[model samples]
Target: MIDLDKVAHDYGGGALLSDITLRLEPGSFHFLTGPSGAGKTTFLKLCYAELVPTAGTVRLFGRDLREMRRDDVANTRRRIGVVHQDCQFLDHLTIAENVALPLAVSDRDPGAQADNLSELLDWVGLSAQARARPPELSGGERQRAALARAVMMDPEIVLADEPTGNVDWEMSLRLLQLLVELNRMGKSIVIATHDLNLIRAAKAQIAARVLRIKDRHLQLAGADL
Candidate 1:
């Protein structure tokens, strides 16, 4: 769970997010929508402790972000997965190898997690492309691979930033289904996206709360949306 209290973050120029207090409970699903430069990315970074807030507090799973040491932060990160907008992968490594990179980075042997990796690839519908390189993949395939990589460690929370931004409507729904599946399995899901249609689609399958950032604040989106 992530708890933010009166969080205000400024990137030198001005306050990007201000007076934001929110809590992500276990098994909760949320969609964050806002205009470009509205601090959606900043909010996600703060949630995962990638950037410390300029003011206020952030506590992840009951531990204060400001109080955690480097090792503590690294360890905390293992419990949370992130899918970035840009699905960057090493061209030399096969999709399977790239998906298993997180295990290696965590000092866990990839060989030990072969079964899990295989299952994950299949879950994301990328089993057929397991040996393909990143450059050879379509946008949907790349995004699916990125999703596989993010959850390789079996994280408790999954934060996706514009996960379906590059894919078509069909592919977007496919990716959304995967996240919804994760939520059903008890992983907290937070997706930062501008696509209202995607949010509306998710609402039909799950009780997803939609939040919007405006005037440097976070508020629950109207039921009409």
Candidate 2:
């Protein structure tokens, strides 16, 4: 669904990522691991067209990102869901409303799909907390809610950045299982995380390829991982 060829990105400094080529095929699962400031987040941004690469080409679906218009980029992004490190939500909005924000902003009526929203909350074990505000939720609850929101549109691909960063081990496992379920349902999944233990744990439950960033390049993680 995402294709990059010799992709390189820079932000006024030297290149953050360079000579990276990757193809994220449909229904494939991948774990992206690297130390801090290793451009894992920047790589994810390129996948979804949030940032245009300084060099080379990034293709979303079949079209080159640089060739897509603003509306085209926006429409294309609807097919890709992103779970940011910070689960930013409007505190005034209820959990259900927050989760349905994607539909709302896309000119779709959230109330029209109320049943699906309910089921999604239930799937994330947030049915009872649907009426609560963001601040009222615990770390795990917030993360789960973020997951629910990310998949609100049934996106074809899900990119999660440090999804378990703020949660406990038990909660991290819970989130991993939820992501695994998404993968089973045929969603392409890329989780950018630094937690090796979490990657090891996921390897036992799913056929996932681990990719590591080193010296501005992407490489397949060795069996030692």
Residue-pair clashes per candidate: 0, 0
Tens-digit lDDT track of model 2 for 98-185: 9998888886777778788999999999999999999999999998999999999889999999999999999999999999999999
Query: How accurate locally is residue 183 in candidate 2, as Cα lDDT from 0 to 100?
Result: 99
lDDT (10s digit) by residue, model 1, range 1-225: 899999999989999999999999999999999998999999999998999999999999999999999999998988998998888788999999999888978977767888999999999989999999999999999999999998999999999999999999999999999999999999999999999999999999999999999999999999877
Per-model TM values vs. the true structure: 0.96, 0.97
What's the residue-level lDDT of 6 in candidate 1?
A: 98
CA lDDT scores, all candidates in order = 0.94, 0.94
